[model samples]
Target: MSKQPLAPSVADLAPDDSILTPYDYEHLGTYLNLLTADAEVTDWREVSRVVLRIDPAQDPQRAWQAYSSHLARAMWMSKLGHRHLLGDIPSLH
Candidate 1:
């Protein structure tokens, strides 16, 4: 049987967003995990398997690249990407 579709997360922002990829809809948790791991200065290989579910033992290069790219995007979200998250801002009365 197929898995149930997940509901969209609040972190899945698109307001003024242009750099989003298909992974953005599904991997918000992974992004947060990477952000937290970055704060902790954790190992990427371990995070790749544990958070990204891409085991380096299976495909080392793909796993490494996936982890690196996602981590960078996660950092981007923690920085400039969040500015676009609201999509549109309403005037505060």
Candidate 2:
């Protein structure tokens, strides 16, 4: 079987597209990690540093934005985005 894509050290602000995008598919693991971190009551700044490779101490705004947006997208995926993943809707690109 093919290997799953590895989570990236850095990620762009998560997409706001109505449908799932290629970026979402590639960052699936990252999204899940974000969800887990939230569930575990992990601090957002710490999550940013560890998971996204962003230093909140150096760039508080950037780190917060990245963590916030990514976590929101992760929740979206858990709610409604999986329907897109399960369907054969073409052109995630």
Candidate 3:
């Protein structure tokens, strides 16, 4: 069976504004560029869009959790060669 895609809630989709202060946007831009450098790589288009929409007042913990969730999903896809089993975001360290 094909796995379902993750449909985050509006609140979960919101980006954390605090990231702007603690990190350089240019650095993120670089990372994003690197992630999309190879044409063979399936770019995280939706993840990038949602991350760019983070609210400045969003909680740091929540923002971190969301990022980590994205990373975890990507890792799972890489290992399994299949989409993730969409569900609740897992807690990360």
**Cα lDDT for residue 65, candidate 2:** 91
lDDT of 1 by residue, 3-71 (tens): 424433322232324565554635567788888987899888888778777788987888787778777
Segments in model 2 whose C-alpha atoms lie over 4 Å from true places: 1-5, 89-93
lDDT of 2 by residue, 18-68 (tens): 899877887888899999999999999999999888999999999999999
Instruction: Give me candidate 2's TM-score against the actual structure.
Output: 0.85
TM-score of each: 0.68, 0.85, 0.33
User: Would you give me the overall lDDT of model 3?
Assistant: 0.36
lDDT to native, each model: 0.66, 0.86, 0.36
lDDT of 3 by residue, 1-93 (tens): 553223323233223332222122223342343234323453344343454333334555555554444454333343441322234233322
Which scores greater on TM-score, model 1 or model 2? 2
